[model samples]
Target: MSDDRRTTVPVWTLATADVKAPGLPAGESMTGERLAELRGVLAVMADEPIVTLEAHPLPDRIDRGRGIPLDAASPLAQHLSQFITQSARTSLTAARATASGECLYRMVVPAKVAAQLGQGTVRSMVSKAGAGGVLSPLVGPSGKIAAHASYVPVGRAAAVGTVGGAGATAGAAAAGGTALTVAAPLVLMAVAVGVSAYADQQRRQAIEHITELLEQLQEDKLDDERSALNGCRAAIDKATAILLDQGRLGVSLGLDSAVHTIDTALSKVEIRLGRWRSALDGIPEDAAVELATLTKAFPGIDDQGGAFRVHLELAALAVALKRRVVVLQAVEHAQSDPGNPFENFTRQLKRDQQWLDELELGVAAVLVRLSAVKLARPSGLRPVFTPSEVDRLMNAAHRIHQLGVGVTVDGRPTDVAIEIARDKDGSVTVFPALPA
Candidate 1:
């Protein structure tokens, strides 16, 4: 079995047999089924080497009720004793008295292991014990499945060779067995609460990280592309809504499933955001300015500038849309898992398709300028291609390819040097290209 299906709690405190009724028979025989059930419980409790067991009398000193003293040698007690003897020991803390009149013999067991118990056992055990079962942390409030108290009702056992035992003998023989039972449903509820709290914490941390990344991009000045800015804003809103909605809907019932959902969602968003950051880092403000300069200075370049600018605009837009796609994809996967409530989804897939179109067009334009086309200007009229023009277009194509778009630049590439000067009117002028 997988670790998740194995067990959760590793330690237990076996407590019970607080006060037997006075004047009862010296011994009572348990049903074979009940004996087997108890044995199965003991076997699981002692299955792990790291598990610690502490045996203590429930309600150590009864202050008010008139009851017989515990036998301390009953079948239940013997099973626990033998199990403890065989299992590795851990340092146990001091034992204290339980609530008065509480008759449940409590045994802390693992959740997954506890889940394996039959409903009949859970029901009968609780009905027999006179107390309630509840799950409490093995350590602090760590929202991890640790220890759960399970109560099993047991009757007094008869002493050997005591045919007409006295009241004292009966009381002595019945000392170890108690008729305490606690409700198991309450423990189930407590376990749910702990798991939910842990999932909530994990979700919150991921949300904070995604929000931080979005906010950083929001603060940047991408004035040239207002549409891209607006798209980014929309994406942020969508991502925030996605996470918040998941939180409101609540985590899945199983701890492992809930944790896996949270982790997968977090991973998808982080990966998408990581890719966006990388794409943005490659295109600096100077690259944008160089593209703008090329548009004004290169002949016939301004005609194609609209397409080039749109490509850059889409690149910015993609930085946000890709993240939104990841968010939607993650949410879609969660909702499709037969548990989540998110039913309707309209994914933002158009962004990726549009990005591919823009990247292809931009790269083709750069390659055309580099390999196929030559300047058409007459003598003394200045050449059409400048070093800065080649450098700017080549760099832009490289950036596009780095963003996961394929681009082809065939043949031996030559470097061209071109000086740029700013006129008094704040216009950029490119000088003649130097020899390659």
Candidate 2:
């Protein structure tokens, strides 16, 4: 995550399809108009300023030949060309899918462009792109399209800041012919010094903020809470060591262990929450109706007495742990080498903080909903959460789940391709697709 090594960029997969031209049939090359139409469809789907696009043969179909580089005269075409080419080169799954007439059109939009165009506009464009059979027989009835977005890390040159500054300084100096030659080296050196100092200052500020957050978490009283907090601290320390080039190999070994500790803790809480939610869902219809009608506390009512209090505590703890993990990830990204020029680290950090805030609010709202339940003392009653309350709590839990603790469902990261097919009747069906 060192500042000199990786630069993260946002990428969007506008559309991917296994195209079959019913009109052209097998072995018939696509006509110019059809190709243009297909390209236009891809353009609309992307909806963002494209940097490049290229096509590659899917792995099984690589024997068919290399990818075709399309002409980039049009803006969308040019963007598509760059995006497709990058996808083919960078992702094995994407590369493999390119063959056999499967087109995986991906685009990497700079943060600036994403900010300008916005996600709402992009989504609207995608909807418009999919509404009609723009490519007709080439990709209409038989095509499968799926869209996704992800972030990618790219390397940045360590000298980028210095070079950029020096260039500006040189440009200003150029007006004085002889003076320019004499001032060039001094200007370059000055620029380099300024850039290094600024980077160092930014890095220091980020580290200080992360360290301060870690300190607050370390004050937790519970043993499990303390352990999770310690893991976060360790992970951040390891990341810092790696990024700062201090004991990198040794620190790297413990990094995963620290991350795993946090993951294991979060998983346990998730499981408990899931079981609690399931218990609520399993309440009998009669019991739910009775509970809803009860206006006052009744003895022996609420068979799952105290359960609400316990689950709420667990939910609060989960939120706290997740907040730490979020900060840990931000540290990793914010400290990466050379830094991502396209990314606004402060803005991203603020967004993560905001998400964590929303998650806390959601859990709090669930707690407020629980206040309506009238728990009765003693045993033997068949009372449970009211149907409406159950529904509300379930919805809140779902929102919390959607926010996620950054845990991958399968415990490891891997791509799963899905095929989304739209029928002639306008109905759509989606299912997982096996890699070729």
Candidate 3:
């Protein structure tokens, strides 16, 4: 798909039990059908690993108020037990659940991976994972799926297990064989650990990708600005060439000030571009947290990655303004005695003036947007452009404004006005105005 047309997918956190409940509930059992469905989902998501977290009830504690603990030696119970460390099991259980009664499983999917899967598929996966099952009807038909702008992992695990092996172990555990009970937890742990590692790798890759995108955007913007500056220089040269060609007539009109103002503005823009490049170079490599901040702050970063294209446009308008002033001067110099002296030149001057007015407004709007741009910084968010850079841009805009004001038909003949007429054929004609 084209970059502009691509869909955005958010990082999602999925839960197999009621996420809003006061205490974690003993999650629904992963039946054969559910297991098969989940494996299918995982198979589709093989490109990206999903992190899983299991919170199970304590073996020793049983609270009737919350729910009953599962049989300690049950396959599910044994799988939960593996997560409990000898040193912190009690504290972890007490903090995570009520009376240590229920088990809760959570899976976190990164944005890239989630992009490949549909919401219906996710709902089905969650449902099969045991949300809204017979044992937990209150949880609702669909699993809890929370979207995040950033990836957040539950915890890290160590070990790796194949997809086929993990499924087989889960199936074996569900079938209730004593021999398989001992092996199930080990296989599940390996799968959990492998997924955690995979998720970590994905996170690192995401951070790198975001960093590269940001840097490339800055580079592209700078290149465009440089091109715009070159365009301005070319427009200024054209205007200068016109004045030189007009010889004494141009000199008499006193248009040197307008040219100088535009030249100064071009210089300021050039300096700002240099500073912008340096600032972009100074930016450090992004960490995961900073990447999250940038992603949230600049969700449409790609869309914003280009020159404003206003500088060159304004420069063109300035050139047109100078041209109009020269034409007015030439008409006066000729001392023409036409019925409607210099009518076409006056009409063209009006059009150029209107264009200049519109371009000035555009520059003002660009300044407003530039003032609002903020980038991620170590000390917190800061304006992307430095105060000096912004001032330079403003100065350039002011010069463009001044060029419009400086070049004008201050001494043009009053009778140089034009008249417009429209025919039935829908064509319009311009002619020198008759008296009154």
Candidate 4:
């Protein structure tokens, strides 16, 4: 360990009482907390913040110290002795305040756990720990380094006290503003700007790709007279793919990992769509049979009545799908335009992406329900969907409308709760349950 090599990070004190424990391995009362605290002390030695450490308790291992007895007769005395030995070992490596007004300390532990403690406290830890290139992994007691903890502190946090004399404050201030101190901040700022610009360019490229795909979807869907279903399906599939790709990009950009909700919804929609299409394939023949029975039971009602009912059900389903895809398309150009490249990061990108995801999920769910419909001719030759289904679709549409096509919320969108209501024309309306 060297004075100059130690990483500069925040420091905190820990009480021996706080370090006591029912240790990690179910019965190990000393090692679990003891190990973590030891790591924390090591981090402090590296001039990094000593906040807390996450304990990785090895399982099915002896909880007691090595070569220790398990006799219940003197268990307490044995445990106390072990604890004292551990404390002494820790103190040997802890930061020292010398008479010359200097602080010096060093310790070592498993590199993986050490890295976790170092994250955010010091940037160097994140890179070094994550890279695992400069240091070797420490093996614990589990016979392959998994159960044992071993580390050798290779860095020390050392600082000399400022001299106390007349005009000390002025001298210290002048010394603090050395070329290194002034140049370091400027260098860091420049690097930050460069990274921000690079991120902005990547974001712009991805968004541009999304917009191009949306445009293609729109152009394809223009001819809705005959190929509405095919066009809508094609568009929806493209949008889903775009979202999934963006999710991967987001993870690469450090927005989040594999647990993105948007990506999950897209996958679910694709699977459910296959099932929905299967359901839809049987609807026409089923509707014809149901209509024939209705005509037989009611002689006055002609086959035209059944035909109209089937047509309405199919139209409703098709329209719902189209709207869902279109809503996704609309968001493409609707989000907030990118701001200064040097200022914006993935946070803004994530927000815009999440808004689209929520809309996609809601609309996709509506399509799922519509696809599940049996579509048999209604008794009165009316649209087969219940009032609730109609209302649900309408509400889904409303949510999409509120979110819009933009990255920013343009319309002071209300987060309203709605109830099913019938209009004068007997059509369903999603009336707001909460008063204005």
User: lDDT tens digits, residues 123-242, model 3?
Assistant: 111223554332122132232211111112121112222212212121111122111111222222222222222222222333343334445455554444334333433343343334
Alpha-carbon runs more than 4 Å astray in model 1? 1-224, 227-231, 234-241, 244-314, 319-323, 326-330, 339-372, 376-436
Per-residue lDDT of candidate 2, residues 1-436 (tens digit): 1123221222222211111111212122343344334434434443222221222211121111111122223222332233334544544544444333344322222233323312111111011346522211112232321111122312111111121211111111112111101111211111112222222222233344434443443323333443453445545444433432212334445656665665565565556445544544454433432343221222112322222333334344444444434433443343343123112323344464454344444444333333333332224355765687776545444433333332222211111122222222222221111110
lDDT of each: 0.29, 0.31, 0.30, 0.27
Between prediction 1 and prediction 2, the one with superior TM-score is: 2
Ranking by lDDT: 2, 3, 1, 4
Kindly report which residue stretches of model 2 are placed more than 4 angstroms away from their true locations once superposed.
1-232, 235-253, 282-322, 334-339, 342-365, 376-436
Candidate 3: list runs displaced more than 4 Å. 1-221, 228-239, 242-344, 369-436
lDDT (10s digit) by residue, model 1, range 1-436: 1123212111232211122222211123333253335434533443221111222222222211111111224222233232332222221111121112122122333333322211111111121123542221111232222123222222222222121111111112233433221111112211122222222222233334434443444423333333323333333333334432333223332323333433343344345335433443444433333344333333223332233333333333333333333334433343344221111111222223244333434444443433222222223455577887666667554543343323332212122111222222222221222211
Q: For residues 1-436, what per-residue lDDT tens digits would candidate 4 score against the true structure?
A: 2222222211112111112211122112333345456544434443222222111122233222211111222222222122222333333322221111111111122233222211111111111334433111122232342233332221111211121211111011122111000111111111222222222222233334334433434433222322433333443434433432221122233222212322443444445445444544545542433333433432212322232222222332333343333223322322222111111222232343344334444444434433333323335646577987566445434432332222221212211111121112222211111110
Candidate 3: 10-residue stretch with minimal lDDT: 117-126
Instruction: Specify the highest-lDDT model's number.
Output: 2
TM-score, cand. 3 vs. native: 0.19
Between candidates 2 and 3, name the one with more favorable TM-score: 2
Evaluated against the true structure, the overall lDDT of model 2 is 0.31
List clashing residue pairs in candidate 3: 26-102, 26-103
